[model samples]
Target: MSKLFSITLSLLLLFQSFNLDMIDVAQLDDFLIHAQFHKQKYGDNLFVFISKHYGELKTQHDLEHREEQKDHEELPFNHQTCSHFSAAFVLSGADFTIPKTPQLADTLSNFFYQESYCHMENSDIFQPPKVA
Candidate 1:
């Protein structure tokens, strides 16, 4: 009887965990919808541009963290890296054009930052960079 009870308890916990993951996924879907809207409002290839830059930022962050740990010192973080990287990517790509307006660029940057923050905050599963 004790063994049966243990098995049932384990199954219950597993099911609860699965339900929680589903809820997280649903929330992620909502974030994606907002991202899609911004992409369309600005330019079709905007998503791809932002995603590529975000990946580069994350990689840089990871490398900085490792270097800091190894050196036992904090490295100076570049505040303008995102803006500079985004500008370069936009200039390099000729297939699609991102709006040159400051407002549009700022809006796109904000969206990318927020989405990246949400993913890092809420999910344990690594989300692959999305291109649209």
Candidate 2:
């Protein structure tokens, strides 16, 4: 009976952990959606654009010895796009689907943290490169 109780307790703990992981994935999905919406409506504000375009800004500053004023180039949807305000406006309905759970992101982040020995990793191999 003690053995059975231990097994049941372990299973319950496992199930609770699994549920929490699912919640994290849901939160990540929500974050991606929020990013998409802000990009659509605000054209990537200061902070978001800073994070997204950090690479380019760094490179530009390195080459020119000056700070980059903006994060991204204006997309067709961002301004007057021939007949439309911007494509992001129309594309706003699309969902940002995360292929893996939030655990994946955390696991990957941790892996990179350990593997790179801190900032020794390449952004291109781990994350997306600058657009322009």
Give lDDT tens digits, candidate 1, residues 1-132: 999999999987997655444444445554455446546764646455344234454465346456334321211121232223334334565568577855544443433333434556456466676789
Q: Please provide, for model 2 over 72-120, each residue's C-alpha lDDT reduced to its tens digit, 9 standing for 90 to 100.
A: 2221112222333544434668899869845444433433334436663
Q: Local distance difference test, per candidate? A: 0.48, 0.51
TM-score of 1: 0.21
Count of clashing residue pairs in every prediction: 0, 2
Model 2 reaches what TM-score against the true structure?
0.20
Off by over 4 Å in 2: 1-20, 45-132
Query: Which has the greatest TM-score?
Result: 1
Q: lDDT score, residue 96, model 2?
A: 90
How well does candidate 1 score on lDDT at residue 121? 46
Supply candidate 2's per-residue lDDT for 104.
42
